[model samples]
Target: MFSLATWNVNSVRMRLEHLLRWLKLRAPNVVCLQETKATDQEFPYTEINEAGYYVVHAGGKGRNGVAILSDKEPREVTIGFPDVDDQEAKERIIAATIEGVRVLSIYIPNGGSVGSDYFLYKLEFIYRLREYLDSYFDPDQDLLALCGDFNVAPEKIDVYDPELLAGHICFHERERTAIKLLKEWGLVDTYRALHPDEKGAFTWWDYQFGAFKANRGMRLDHIWVSRKLAQKLKKAIIDREPRGWKKPSDHAPVIAYFEL
Candidate 1:
């Protein structure tokens, strides 16, 4: 059995203490981190290397970074999509192969607002991701698990108040359509597959207006498995306790267990 977790740390430097504490407790076999908000030069590679894991990171200046950490050193590591055509290489995706399984960490763009340029970029990012996945669709290659802060609430149940957030970027129709297109490409939401009827569970809470205290949150973080590995899924859950810690990130970690 292997346990994998995905978290949007918000800022790796600011949350290092919280991460160390969580790592000491849970000790997941693999961790996919998003929104690191630190450049490659700024990442504390030596510190993480001493934590008994191998790390693969990709990040740009102040936003949108992704990384993968593995208990056993990965055999291969690739940062960003090769098909991105140089124009979209802002460091948002990273993939590594550990014990034969392919783990991908992605930090999808958070569309700033509806019908804005940032929103268009977000959609284009998804399109690029689709192209990347299409290049590796062979089932015989390796089992794949894709995860991170997708910045998307997939369904109404994913948010506390759907109607109140009708046109919001995370819950808007265009974003949902883009996500649907990806799902149609043979990826399964491992968490939702395991808990088909569960509700009121969320992975992100706003830092403003006491959102966490009120339990008003959105399920923005996610774990997705290829159809080949979905059958091996054992469990998936959101660790909300981390969000309650002092100076915690607005996002919490989502864990998934699989029988390898």
Candidate 2:
């Protein structure tokens, strides 16, 4: 049984304790973290080492960072899109091979509003991710898992109130379509594939207005597995305990188990 988890920590420096505690409790073999918001110089390498995981990270000083942690040392670590010099996306993506599996930590941008520049960039980023996969890997043969805070809710069932949130930034049809195209590239949404009809199984909630208490959230975080890895998938879940913890990030951790 190999367990892998993905979470948007919001800020690694601010939520270090929570991460340490969760790591001890859950004991996942590999972890992919997004929104670490710490540059290489400021990353808590020593502390993470003490916690018993080898980590590789990329990011800026204040925003859009991604990291992967494994109990064993990771190899073939890659940062940003391969063969593409995308500065804005530099810190938002990271990948490494751990225990014979290629895992990616991605922090997809949250578009501010419809038809905005950021929104367009968000769409472009998703397409570029597909291209990246096409150029580097074959989903039919590779043992790959892509995990992160995707920022887009792929289906109506993923949100608490579909009618109310319709056309919202994360729940928009365009965003859903983009995610669909990505999935068509030979990836499976692990949780949805397992719990096909589950509703309101969200991973992110607003930090305001008691959204977490009310369970008014969106399933923005995901663990997408390639076809070969998907065949080994035994379980997938959204662990909401961390979100209820004091000083928690708005996003919860998503965990997947495989009979590897």
lDDT of every predicted structure (CA atoms): 0.86, 0.94
> Per-residue error at 9 for model 1, in Å?
0.3
Model 2, C-alpha of 184: deviation from truth (Å)? 0.2
Cα-based lDDT at residue 37, candidate 1: 85
Give candidate 1 misplaced runs (Cα > 4 Å). 139-141
Question: What value does the lDDT take at residue 70 in candidate 2?
Answer: 93
Candidate 2 residue lDDT tens string, 1-260: 99999999999999999999999999999999999989988899999889999999998966889999999999999999988898868899999999899999999999899889999999999999999888888999999999999999998899999999899899888988998999898999999999999987999999999999999999999999999999999999899999999999999999999998
TM per candidate comes to: 0.96, 0.98
Question: Measured by TM-score, how close is model 1 to the native structure?
Answer: 0.96
Top-TM-score structure, candidate number? 2
lDDT of 2: 0.94
